[model samples]
Target: MAARRKAPAARARRRSAALAVGLGVAPAAVVVLLAACLPSTPPQAAEPAGPPLPPVSSRWAVAPPPAVAVAGANPSRAAAVDLVDGAWADEVAAATGIPRRAVIAYAAADLTVAHEQPSCDIAWNTLAGIGWVESRHGSYGGATLTKRGLVAPRILGPRLTGDGVAAIEDTDGGALDGDDQWDRAVGPLQFIPETWHRWGADGDADGVRDPNNIDDAALAAARYLCRSGPLGTERAWRDAVFTYNPLTRYINDVATRANEYAQRVELG
Candidate 1:
């Protein structure tokens, strides 16, 4: 789940901008100067701003409780993901700082997992925690998530060239990450090429197991977490999250966010 750090490139670009400023160029003129170097794409719709994310802290001693009560699964629902009540999703999305569309996907994914693997006890907020950490619910890098749960200008993590990440050579041959030299994490849940191959799912029943689609990615992440075994207890929950990403900070971050979402939903 970890990828190359973006700080280095960001720092390098800042230094370059400073040098241009020293060369008798106004700071505002840098944008015009760098126009040719920037990606040329259609203007994206503005992403909604939510409350600031709560700071990371340990909640691993206890797993977060469910955000809402789910009546198991409904066979009359068109899809497993439709188990989430729409009105409840809207309220929780606003209270928890997740986009509405993302709330639907995350809640639906958890519901789907509940139907398929109820023993896992995966909660929607836990999936929301991962979604926030992974790609801000598919709104990272100025990208926009459409009503259909499709993220435009697809989210891609830095290439895993071993600088500070695992040195993975190209596995998808540019098919998913568009890089033949090395593999990069893809989608909102940040699944690597190999992991996506193993756990990808079609949450929206669109017939395509696309990682770029939030519905698909969220379900894939749910299934991946469920595969780690039952999360009915604290240790099991921590182990499942750590298995998703080994870093202690990552586990804490997810726990903190998930807990906050649960609290927010309760208050709402």
Candidate 2:
């Protein structure tokens, strides 16, 4: 991206005309005055942004999460389904201090449910990867998830109005994003209002469905990925991620970060 500025030439021209009209100055003199006022040559243009860098390795991404974090839910269930790598989440959290609650969510999303879709193998790290990209495990913008897994000061993305983002019209009647004119991606996982309405889930097995909840969003994301067929092969992974968001950079970032989280957590 380049920083754009208003050219001084236009302003100079306006001043030149006023000066020429106010005083009976010669046209040549006015021209000379304007020339003196304006730049000899155009200002140097701002440099364009560089091309998107390829993933450092298909297995890992390089960015670190934001340093500050809002307090999150306790996530200590009295009767919870055990994750395949249940202890791994606690291990990573103890090792890295990234919040055991979030680590548990990732592990559960990865291993707990088949999500009613047998073909897909949604990795916990992949969910963690998307979390890293989306809302930093619901700790974005100095906000945090409530103990119920609901995003407290719910995250809302910039309006998608076909400007540079998608051209999705409002689907929910301002129920989720409070925007009836246009659609906004809501919550840490960033689901557009309409999509959330259709796919809103209750991963915590709670009675109500809320897109703002990390458990619900994660399970919903898993369901979405599973809809794209099997995720066992690389092609399957690409297809599933493409279905989620159709940008090469997005998919690559997700894949890279997911793998990195996977590697780190799997250490235990």
Candidate 3:
């Protein structure tokens, strides 16, 4: 009867011991299971970048090309020659056998005095006519004098006179005496020595004032016009031409010729 009474206490003690063992082992098992089931996180991905640009070239920034000089006959000379319906150009071509283009080039080189001047046509016409009257457009015996007696040496060709004596007979009569004097008249323009000395400009870039050369003559005439004041003006221009050759007829003739040449060029 005594043994039966202690059985319940022993059974309760056994059950409590079993519960304690289970609780202690349960926490360690849960921690191990969690570690095995969970996956590791990968490293964060970097952002994508854009492509690089190309470098600029130095040659692309270089300057433009320089301007070239104009070709063809001189506008002024063309105007002048064209004024007489191509009379002056035809005459020059016939006399020297030089092409019209060459004559125009010569005229441009001669008449261009300053950067800012009137049309070369005026100078060309005046000069062409004067040359015709003076040297017959370079057709005169190469060396001779004007109406006024003066010694004009032939610069382009052989000397007409030797030892200060006339060789070629004076077709215009004994207008120019055989004095061999260096009168004012010079070049194809027949510029007086005194006048040329004062206002004689280097029409051509020949380092000297040569009135015999048509190119020089044209330039001198242009310079004279510039000195006279504005172009297309009657009084001022007329006065200037008179100064060159103290004659009204000469001025009128030059003006007429220049106007004619201007018309021709304008038409063309």
Candidate 4:
């Protein structure tokens, strides 16, 4: 029998070319064929895709502590009134002096309204707190002489006073129109003309939501709180307090006062 003929080197080149074409890199066939003609190394393994990373948290500031519950007291009773009263006296003697009965009454009214409109719940305590801070239970008025000198008081009129100018200076550090009497903050609630225009309501049913009247002011505060929605959660409540005033200390103070009041009411 004739000896089997050896496969031609050209046949090997063709096979390599076919392999390269199958791999979508026909040009690489020439290199592979040349390597096969010479010495060759083992093929390397392909790398797999890596998994994706987890997302980062976006919060910047640390969240405040959860509001403390009143000691030995239920949150929904006469204890709440004492909690508010004693706390107000201890925490904010300068700006607020709300009676326990008033706060309890307001809270009850707010709860009743909340059944009809859930959004009002969060605002009830917050609004009351703000009112206490702003007017000291509606004891303050516009325009008075201070130790510093004659201070412009917030007067209800078409004109602003020197005291009004001073009041503006005190609150805004001379940024407002201190020269104009129209810049006065009105009523027991201290409603500036612009704020009154936007938020004023018929709170006492005497046909006006006057910020100067305690009843009207209280109602307006309740309405504002319901609108703000702070009562939903601790963060939201803190944010709502900050929105009322941009100061962190103010927020802390308000929360502290509220907690104190709640606790006092519980004890009483």
Candidate 5:
């Protein structure tokens, strides 16, 4: 067999994957999983309902306590309206013409999990900025995030075969993206199987931790970015975003997009 190739800095962290350099997407938003990171200690196997997330600490500078997990999406469960007092999700949706549930869930997840990543202060727009660049809020190629947050027809990245892209062998046995020859980035957030395996989150409480779901993907991205350090500052944010795709251009693009989203939120 030929020698195992290494992915660029964009894929794996050289443990070793070069990871998601480009997914044939637009210039600024190069949505992709940075290869995959190894999972912390496996979480406890137990069913959880719509329980409140744990408190984040102000001390952690690297990775959550290896115990931070997100609840999966549940169609039956209503999204929290705590962003604003007495504003129903539908009310917000009708007023803003935005996906109310999606906005709230992303915001809630960001605020909730930031506890685990005390240093990381990711905003919902930061994620929306990523989503916009990645799949146009799950509208890429006519794909959409359903009421339950599943991106239909599934968004996948090009195969990492070392031909101008990183050469990642079939790691998950074609489980996540189903390529069989190599792993592909799946879902609106475009998480690679290896990375998802280590950091996949269940944002909806629906039992299965599906990355194709925006809620899950957003939360997983949050945890991954925060796992390193705080994102409240420019330097810190760049470093965190760089972990997703270790390219200076990619990080800069994400920063620009994220700032745009933040401004829109403030103005809107």
Candidate 6:
């Protein structure tokens, strides 16, 4: 497996530029500092939906039938969102101000991970926080997240040219990110081609693992987070989020947004 690319200071700058371009569609504005630092411990908090999610013995125990049954064009072969309750998604999305489609993708990813790796116990809101922070749930630059979970006119981060950023030469040869000279973080989750090559998932069971798809990206992010350890504990949660981006301010921002989403659900 390829080593994960270290997120560079350029990402902070790229995020600010992307967010600024899509201010109207962005849920919240984020101010990022261009400084690298170790991850700090975040506050202890309850999981988004209450207790830790129950674990499953294996994927076969919970994997749904491979039927394209979402009542729309380009339905997924196995969305796995049948595990999530529709009413609950509607309520939580409305309360937390997250897009309903994005909410479903996050919650579905959490539940799928629960089935695949029960010990991780990642939360949906945490994924939401990441989505909001990274491309505003695929709405960056006014990109449209269609009903099929595909982000049109896909989002791409700045080139990794070592010009105040990680000096990663092009790995995909312009295949995934359309840049042969240099690699750009692709899709809503802003995963570089090399990292995505190792961790990308077929979230919607569309037979194609695409970073441009919300369902795929959310699940991939969850799997990546679980690599740190179970997130039921505060230390573990902090560690997992830090692995995504090893910066104190980044971890704190994600924690704050995640906690806010959880709190909103409780208040409602």
Candidate 6's clash total is 0
Ranking by TM-score: 1, 6, 5, 2, 4, 3
Backbone clash count, each prediction separately: 0, 0, 12, 23, 24, 0
Give stretches of model 6 more than 4 Å off: 1-78
TM-score of each: 0.73, 0.66, 0.44, 0.46, 0.68, 0.72
Q: Model 3 over residues 104-169: C-alpha lDDT tens digits? A: 423443225323353311333344444444444444555544322122454222222322321332
Residue 230 in model 4: shift from native, Å? 5.6
Q: Pairing residues by index, what is the TM-score of model 3?
A: 0.44
TM-score of 1: 0.73
Greater-lDDT candidate between 5 and 6: 6
lDDT of 2 at 79: 14
List of clashing residue pairs for candidate 1: none
Lowest-sum lDDT 10-residue window in model 4: 10-19
TM-score: model 5 vs. ground truth: 0.68
Better candidate number, 2 or 6, judged by TM-score:
6
lDDT of 4 by residue, 164-263 (tens): 2222222223222243323544543344444445555553345654544544544444544445442445544544443333334445545544544333
lDDT of each: 0.60, 0.50, 0.34, 0.34, 0.53, 0.60
Candidate 2 residue-wise lDDT at 25: 12
RMSD of each: 15.3, 20.7, 52.1, 33.0, 14.4, 11.9
What does the lDDT read for residue 193 in candidate 6?
82
Cα-based lDDT at residue 219, candidate 3: 53
- Which lDDT tens digits does candidate 1 get at residues 1-268? 1112211100000000000011111121221111122234312454233222231223322333333323444523567556565666667777777898888887777666666776676767777777777777787788878988988988887666766555677878889889999877787777777677777789988799988898988888777766656666655565555555544455566766776776676555
lDDT of 6 at 179: 95
111 Cα displacement, candidate 2 (Å): 3.5
> Of models 2 and 6, which has the larger lDDT?
6
